[model samples]
Each structure stands twice: as structure tokens, then as C-alpha cells.
Target: MGAPRILVVDDNKDMAQGVAMVLREAPAEVESAYTADEACARLGERAFDLVVTDVRMPGQDGMQLLDVIVERWPRSKVVMLTAYGTVQSAVEAMKRGACDYVTKPFNNEELLLVVKRALRERQLEEDLQRLQAEFEGRYVFEGLVGRDAQMLGVFDAVRKVAPSHATVLVCGEHGTGKELVARAIHRLSGRKGPFVAFSAAALPDTLIDAELFGARKGAFTGADHDRKGHFVEANDGTLFIDEVGSMPPLVQVKLLRVLQEREVLPVGSSTPTKTDARVVAATNTDLLRATREGRFRDDLYYRLSVVRVALPPLRDRIEDVPLLAEHFLSRRCSERGIAKKRLSHRATRVLLLHEWPGNVRELMNVIDRAVLFCQDDVVEPKHISFDEEATAADLSEPQSYEATKREVLERFQRLFVERLLHECDGNITEAARRAGLTRAAVHRMLKRLGIAAPHPEARRG
Candidate 1:
């Protein structure tokens, strides 16, 4: 909420002040510490977003400060400053958890750029931590999974408004877990009645009103007996209307009346019955745009959206893919009474790179299929497939067997190296170590595959 707080540590007073002055021009609050002990004292007093410390300071040097900062304030980003001859030391600092390093005698603009980058990274890490906390049961909401900042924001909104009686409009792309959110809201709403769900798209336009509001006996062709509707069934609780944007315009007017008057008027009945059902409606389409096009009632949209919750598409929160996949695997395995299957590293890499146009639903189906087809304990890339049309198109290709084989191998090699580099933070030495290969061999592979390390700052021996 405030300017990122930064601590500048250098033994030279003038140097620290000059660096602080340069950083002050940026969006930061800079504090000076002449020694590692002083910096430690300052850190103990308050948490900083980023710390800039010289590599060679009096007594405990920057490396020591780096280690202490890494241990004490793991979320804070540290940038090491060093002379040309000690670049290796700066790289060592990076291994010790420093984000990036800077050579001494740098200009204001260069320093500001690195500082800004570090702060941005700090914010991302913080968001990730918050997300992890939410995933680990800090929030009482259930059936929803994600630690992305956007998802956490949704959780915060749900927590704030679930206790109230305000109507909620859950908007997102299809299969983004809008219904899960609605169920969570109801579960946490402290309501006594059941959580009733109705799919507006599945219901016929002729019967939607009768489904939402009770119909008296002999009211319609199929109405042989009096029937209670979702509003009454969900009385004193939540009524989740899925794909609500598909409701016919005529039904929209009746829904708006229920919201306005807190009463449901049955079809073919003159009397209106009072009801207390909290409405939580979801739609994948742009209801506001639908209103502009006269397909939906604008007044009803406003009424249902008194408290809106928008779910983030899977693509926007790729970091949560592993967790979601694992969750699905365990749940499905338990359901089928089969042993749990794990995702191979290569399979997970492919999942991470995929463009999930169908959002979470597509991912779930992919995992489900992979589990069923995978004979081994681990699900591999060959076992995972999506888009039947794409599969058919590929099958119809007339390429020679050799050409197809070469292409597939090359693609697999590229993906493998890229994922390793990413996991190792683009440090070729670390990647090589993890892959059990020589650094020179890894470089050769990268060159052959036409791949370059993405993080230049992370390059190390």
C-alpha cells in the first residue's frame, strides 16, 4: 500500500547516502545502514521490501547480511553490490537467495531499474505466500482451489460478504469454478436451509418460472400436483443460479420482482408468497453487454450483482496448476477405489505449457483421462491428451514416420531443458547439477535446441 521500503547498506556513509538519494527518486522509502549489524538491527525493527547491501562491508560483510536476510526475512528481495573483480562473490550471493546483483559505480537510472525489478519480485513472492496460506486451510471455504492473488482476492471478498444477505453475481469464463464459489458462499453463510442449485440453461424457458417459483396444481400441462420451487426449497439459505445469463427475457422480469419484493408469485396463482432466499447467480457471458443488446434485463443484472465475484481463468493462474491437478488426482483415485497416480515431471511441464481454453474443466477432464489410460504409477506426456479435434487433425497428417518422430523428439528435448532451466532459475550450473549432466553438455543441448536461458541474472558457474 505504501512505497516499497528499501534498506541501503554500505560502510561508506557518503556512498550509502548517495545510493539512497538515487533510490529516493523511485517509488521507495530508502533507509541507510553503515554496517551489517546496523542493517540487522533495522531489519529486526521492521520488515523491508528490498535490501541493497555492498558485498564488502566492515566486520560482517554483505554475504553474511545476505545469509541473515535470507533466513530472517525470506520474502524480502536482496540486491548485492560489488566491484568488477568480485562478480563471483555476487553470484555466490545470488545462490544464497539474492534476487539480483549490481556492479559498483552504477548510475541512478540503472540502480532504480534493478530496485524496481526487485520490488516487483517481492510483491509476487508475497502474493504467492498469501495464496499458499489460503490453500492450507486458513480460509474455511471449500471445493475451490487456488493461491493466485486473484483467487485470494475472491476468497477475501467471499469472507467479507458471505455473512450478509446481499445477492452475489459470480462472473467468469465457463468452467472457472463459479458454482464451487457459490457453494462456498452458502456453506459459510451460516444459513439453516439447503443450498439449492439450478441451471438456467438446462431448464426449458417455459418451465424456468415454474422451477424458480412454485406452480399450483393443474397450473400447466405437466403440473398434476402443487410443486414448491427453488426459492422456497432454499428458503433461509442460498439459491445458486448457474448460467443465469441464459434465462429468457420474460423469466428475467419475474426474477427481478422476487429480488425487489422478497416474494415469489407462483404461475397461475393470484397470491404471492413471502420468501427469504439469498440469490447467488453465475454467468460466463457478459450480462452487462447482454443488457445493452436487450437480451437481458438491466435492472435484474444490477439486482443480482449487488456483490459481484469474478473467478480468474486457469491461464491467468498457471502457478496453481500443480496443486489443482494433484487435488483432482487424489479425489478421483479415491472415488474409483484405485491407487493414486502421480504426474511425471515431463507431463507436468506439458500441462504448464498448455493453453487451457476450457479453463479448469478441461484440465480436470485431461487429468481424468490421463489417470484412466496411464498403466504405470506416474502419468506421462503420452498419456495426456486434449482436444479431440486436434488429435484427429494430427492423425490425418501425411508426414513421413521419420519426420514425425524427429519433430516429437526435438519438441520433447526442448521442453525438458526449458523446464529444468526454469526450475533452476536459469542457472546452467544448477540445472546441469539437477539433470546430472556436465555444464558443457547442457550448453550444447541448449544451442542445438535453439534455446537461451531466460534469466540472465541467474547465470552461474
Candidate 2:
């Protein structure tokens, strides 16, 4: 937290002193080392925030020192200084763990700029690590991983309402972990019976009644033998009903009756059966809106939503992407019996910038695929791919049709522009020309869409 400590290492005493003096402009604690061995000695004594080392040093070269620092210190950033002819070597050093590199004839401003950028990036990584450590076990509930305010609120609500006998309604977009939340609630509910799950969307209207309420031996066609329904099977336990909004009108009325009477009237049965099932329903549709539109019953909606749990979409909680990605990566690697792999800085940026239309499910799949395809110990940007065809799910809460249309159009525009820029090798002028648009218009669009313009070096690459 004090002024950052920096070490300048070069075989030439004059050159080392000169680099150290230039870094004084940063108001940093700067020291000079005439050899890589001397630099190692200094590093062993105390940690330095950044180390600027020449690529070709006498006896022990800068590359050897880089390997040592990477293996031993790990956190301290190293920047390579190379002559014009050895720029390729500097780049190789970067791949081996150097934060950045500067050419020998670089201006003081250029060197200082690179150093400051590296320092800022190091700080950001440290902050993210601290946050991950702090929230790893605390914010995680069951299999869910998040530290976002909205997710934290969901966790808190689940804990408080799990012990009660209320009928809970979980509302979220598809793949936002609604089922995971239901399981967590069930685990915490301390029920004596096993948890039973049923999806109304996965069944036909004719079979939904038989599935929810038990049937007699000759109840209807295909009712060859007596069978217990979800309510009966989940007796004295939690019954997780997914896609509850898809239930037919008659089934909804029957469900409402079961909730009120604490029993189920089986098909072709003379007497009602008593049951004590705790209902936990989930839907990706806006049931309240459905009620107003007369597509769903208002009384049923109210009864099901006794304790509502709303989950925010992935895009709304982008900061948790890194944590979730790491979780998925670790699990995938362990499952495959492979050594752990890590994401490169560029790969991490790729993950962070994505919109994650499929939420956690999509992220997990991406990580699994990356782990399976990555050849090295690190996952690079080239190994990361997004599903271009997966459009965002419909909003769980109701919104004006025009607003929804605008949102969808913006998402499409952003994806189109990104692909264009990528195909043109990140050259704004080339992308604009190819797209039949002005370069200025493209720049404006990038700014409006909160997209970072590609760096000149990246464009060349």
C-alpha cells in the first residue's frame, strides 16, 4: 500500500542506474541491480511490486531469472528489456510469465506507461483474489457460486424461508439455477421424506393430472395399475414442480385445491387422500402477468408465490464470472483426472466480456469444453468459444413489448459488430469499410455498446 517497490536489473551499471532514475518519476521505491544474480539476492530479501530486467545479462540471463521469479515469487511482475533484434525473445519471455516487455531504445514515457499498466493489472488481480478467498465458502450455497448482491439476497431468503411450510415460487430465466435453489431449500427444510421433482413443461396436458394427483387402477387409458402421484410420492417432503406456469387450467385448479385441502383427490377415486407435501414451484414465465392476461388463475398464482425468490440473469452479475469459471474449470479437471489448468490473462478477459446468455449452465459447458480441448496447462483465448446461436431467454418479469424489442436489437447489434471487428482483424477502418459504414460511426457504436477498441498491436497480430 506504500509507494510501489520496483527493481531495475541490467548488466551495465550505467544503464541500470539510468532506468532506476527514470522510474523515480513514478515516485516509487526504486533499486538498481548490475546482474541477474544480484537481482535474485535482492528479491530474496524482500518482495518488489515490479522487476524490469534486460533480456541479455552476463552469466545468468534475464530469461533464467524470469523462470526463477515465476516459480518462486509468482506474484511479483517481471518486464523484459530487449534490443530491437531480440524483441522476439522478449515476447517469448512474456509467454513464460513476464508481464510485459520494452525495447532498448524505448522512450522514458513508453517504459513508464507499460510499468504503470502492469502494476495496475497486478493490483486488480490481487483484489479479485482477496474477494474470492473471502466469499468462497460463505457466499456459496450448495452448488451455487456467487457474491453478487442479488445472489446473496437469494441465499439469505432461501435460508430464512427453508424451514417454514410455505409454498415457494422461484422465478428466473432458464439455466439461472432455479433447480439448484430448490434443492438447497429442500436440503435445509429437514423433511422426513425424499425430494420429488416434476416438470409440467415436460408432460402432456392429459397426463399432467395423473402425474400430480394419484390414479386408481382403472382411472383412465394407460392406468393399468394403481400409482402414486407426485403429491403422494413426495409426502412429508419437498415437491419441486418446474415450469409450473405451463400447467393446464384444470390442473392448476386441482393443484390449488390440493394446497388448500392438504390432500389430493386421485382420478377415479371415491375418497380424497390426506398428504403433507411441501411445494416448491419454479417458472421462467411471469405468472402474475399470466394471471392478469387470464392465461393463469390469480388465486393459484397467489397461493404458489407465498415466498417468492427472484434470480437475476448472468449479465446482471458479471463480476462473479471469474469465480464461477474457476469453479467449473477445477471441477472439470478433477473429473477428468488431469492436472489443474488455468486461464491466461487474455482468456480471462474473453470470459469477463461475454454476455453469458445461457447463464451458469452455458459457462460450465464452455469451461468443460475448454478443458477437454486445451493442450497446455493454460487455457488461451483461442480455446474459448461462445455459442453464437443461443439467444437470451425471455425475461422472467414482464416488460413492455417495445422495450424487449429494443433490448434484443441491441444484443444483436453488439454481436454483429464484434464479429465484424474480429473478422477484419480488429482494424476499425477495415471493419467499417467491409460493413459499409463510416469508421466514426463504428467507433461511436463501440463506445455506446461499452466495447473496448482493439489495441494496435492486437490488430496487427
Top of the candidates by TM-score: 2
TM-score of every prediction relative to native: 0.56, 0.58
What global local distance difference test value does model 1 have? 0.86
Badly placed stretches (over 4 Å) of model 1 are 1-135, 138-141, 389-461
Instruction: State how far residue 171 of model 2 sits from its true place (Å).
Output: 0.3
* lDDT string, candidate 2, 250-295, tens digits: 9999999999999999888978999999999999999999999999
lDDT of each: 0.86, 0.87
Model 2, TM vs. native: 0.58
Give the lDDT of residue 284 in candidate 1.
94
Candidate number achieving the greatest lDDT relative to the actual structure:
2
Query: Candidate 1 has what TM-score?
Result: 0.56
**What is the lDDT, from 0 to 100, of the residue 357 in candidate 1?**
86
